[model samples]
Target: MAVSGGIAAYKSAELVRLLRKQGAKVRVVMTRSAMQFVSPLTFQALSGNPVHSELLDADEENSMGHINLVRWADVLVIAPATANTLAKCSHGLADDLLSTLYLAATCPVYVAPAMNQAMWHKTVTQENIQKLKSHGVIIIGPEQGDQACGETGFGRMSEPLAICNRLMDETPTRCLSGLKVLISAGPTREPLDPVRYITNRSSGKMGYALANAALKAGAKVTLVSGPVMLSPPVNADLISVETAAQMHAAIIGKAPAHDIYIGAAAVADYSPMITEQGKIKKQDDQTTLTLTLQKTRDILAEVAQLVNRPFTVGFAAETHDLEQYAKDKLTRKNLDMIAANWVGRDLGGFDSEQNALQVFWKNGQKNLAMTDKNQLAEQLISLIAERREYERGNKNTA
Candidate 1:
């Protein structure tokens, strides 16, 4: 969603690209004032959706035009939400399609205010913004800095990508909001003293994506990361752990009261039962040694059985028999939902940016097709919201 009326309107195209890249469907609406700076085709090409610019068109109004588009948005985003558009919306003046939709919307509306700095500080504009917010519209940042006008201050429309990024990462769905969510990512090194260790093929992409997604959906995220070069999501309470023991310690201490636990880290299933205290010698040609393998603590199951357990999500990576193994894990771990994937596919489960997931709950399932992890995260978050609400409704009725 974009509104045009300021120079910042140009950045909206980049925002559309980012949103679409992340697998979000974007539709754009432009105010008449916005048409002065950019053409509708520019956005149409970027959004891949028709750029809707006029409130009344002979080709459109005959079809009951704006009212049709009015109902079709998961969220309404307005960039460069002009003073005129803002006043109209805040005042409930349905003189235009955009304003009319503002009044009629049943979904969230996010406006990125962009205007001259002085215009932004005006009492009338500020009050109108307050009015819109009071009525439930979201106000994304109009970060202060340089502006297209010679002078600069507050009133730059956030770059289009920034607006979508904020929407995806910070809009409070409470699907995981107000809940302490602890997740781990990457592979841990199991040390046999200070000189030797072991690890796995987990890149932590899936886990980190989950953390980012969960945080975006409003969860307080705690990410216990292994020694991967991955940067933890912004705002995640990050704890860097090096070995299975350290990871276990972190989880044991932090997992108890968590509202949702996603054990997506590919923790080593086996550790050397007897690790030599120091580095082993380069022995003779024919030498045999017996080493015992022991099971690490089952993190997901442990969290699932806690006294006041939160909803639990699990991940299963499989080479074959994906459904059988995933279903088994879901029941065995007492997970509320399990996202399963195949490792040997072309998608490269360990390090690829794109992959597919088969998400399963009790009686329902969804297939997340090959796409960027970020987009899949969005779909997953939306599902999480629906599932949580549905369960809540059931519990209340029962």
Candidate 2:
């Protein structure tokens, strides 16, 4: 573990403890400035190893310390990676011990950034992050929440447990291996005219995250996505669609072949019954214009009612009565599960980077706390896998 200089450095102590509790052999590497927030003795005692703090220690340097350290590591994790450290890494500045190790290390590098919300949102910092990711660095998070700076935004380090789990490879188990997953994502456009269309604020982040999570769990993933600015996961087969009808058709054609179906799209419930071929002209004295509407296809309900249906999941983004609406949707659609969240809130759901879920099944539910969509997706996928396995086991016993 490499600790950088940031207020979040304090969290590294708990992170080290979690890593050790998971049976990992840990070593402490602190930058010169990191020693300000936390004492080196604290980490050394927890890790039960000598703390490496200098690039010019005669004893360690004579033994080719940096190169040796790089060779000895299976993975190098940087928690509380400050903006300065990120900048140094992106530009390949080896002026400091941690940056030097980052440059020399052949092992996988995982960085968890921590800084003020404004600093995190700076264009330069975002560009630096892109550069690091381009070099195969696995960026864990700077999750959105209360920061030490008394501001709430996207500059806090992830929880110690989450970081520790990744370090120990304790999560993201490949339990869904050999299964095929079909998912729909984004907001389907309902056209009003040639130039105008109605769509929701769905950003497709959640669905894309789920698709990626399923792929990581060794599932063959097919993603049917609506128009969105996000890139598709490289491992998943992506089929792009515009309108809700197109998405419905795409899913119906592929749903039979998959073992799981997750309808994550915020598909338009109603489309204009009559779409004008050209842009509607402005009238000289028009006060109101109305258009008839027709219900779009119920993709989830259709798939759930199939004679040989897959394990079906639906998503509900509600503004009020969240639980009631979600449970009602689950029963009405005959779905195996439904993940619901309240949209139009400051915290999560609908084009936000974070989300919480109230997942409902027949007789039980799980409330997932708000966090990064990626992490939430992993948790949701794991739960679905477990539920599916239990159902299979019950059938066998019966």
Candidate 3:
């Protein structure tokens, strides 16, 4: 693991601990600036090895630490990869030990970027990132959220557990190779007037994570997303929608060509029967207002009922009776699977980074304990792939 200079450098320490806990043999390499936020001794204690930060050290083999470190590593990871380090690597400048090691390493490389929101959105920084991707380096999160700089956007380093899970989920074999996946995400709005709308608390974290996981499994992905602050995963076909009706249309129109459809969006159950063209004005005598609501289309059920439906997956965010509600929905909608989790909780629900799920299908269920949404998404995708293959095999034999 390579740590660069940034406030997120502290997160790298936790990442090292997670990697160690997962039984990985970890080695730490740091840029000189990284040590400003975190001490080398801290990493040395977690990694159980001496930390490497200098490009040249007299005590090392042939006084060449970069070459030796590259040889010793099976994979190279740079967490909190600052803009400077990214630029250096992109331009093939190896003035520092971390960049030199990146150039020297033969193993797979992963970079998790962390910077201010403005810096992350800069054209030059994005270009550098694209260059790294073109060279086969895996880029992880710079997730959207509050940053140490008192601004909010896409510049936070992915959580330590999420980064660890992503590293662990990496495999040579692509499970969903050649498959096409369609996913819906985020909370759909139901407009009452030109200015006001009804929507849920969904943050679309899980859906985005699933899209990324499916992509990692080598599937071609289409993400039909509602309004969200997140940056869509690289290489996905993104279709943006704002309302439940629009989401329904997008998903229905695109479902047939897909091999898998995961309905992760929280579409509004109902919408105003009549939408006012202009904002409703307050009247002096009117203290109360009433409006009728009509049921919105059921996207999951419609997808499942298609003549040649894709393997359908649904999600149920319940406040109570999770198993009952989930199972009922699975049967009621003729879904292949349903993932249910408790909402209105202190942890692991809408708008939060962590989540847990009780996944159900006919005669089977699995409890995925609360964890980072990214990790959970990877597990769920694996399960979906396995179940899909099993069902296909059974059909062939029958």
By TM-score, the best candidate is 2
lDDT of each: 0.78, 0.88, 0.90
How well is each residue in 278-298 modelled by candidate 2, as lDDT tens digits? Answer: 999889899889889999989
What C-alpha RMSD separates each model from the true structure? 15.5, 8.0, 10.7
Cα deviation at 254, candidate 3, in Å, is 0.5
Q: Would you list the rank order by TM-score, best first?
A: 2, 3, 1
lDDT (tens digit, per residue) of candidate 3 on 180-236: 999999999888898999999999888988887787677999999999987676678
The regions of model 1 sitting more than 4 angstroms off are 1-174
> Candidate 2 lDDT (Cα, whole model)?
0.88
Question: What RMSD does model 2 have?
Answer: 8.0
Least accurate 10 contiguous residues by lDDT in model 3? 130-139
Relative to the true structure, candidate 1 reaches a TM of 0.59
Model 2 lDDT-worst window of ten:
166-175
Ranking by lDDT: 3, 2, 1
Clashing pairs in 1: 15-160, 15-161, 169-216
lDDT-best of 1 and 2: 2
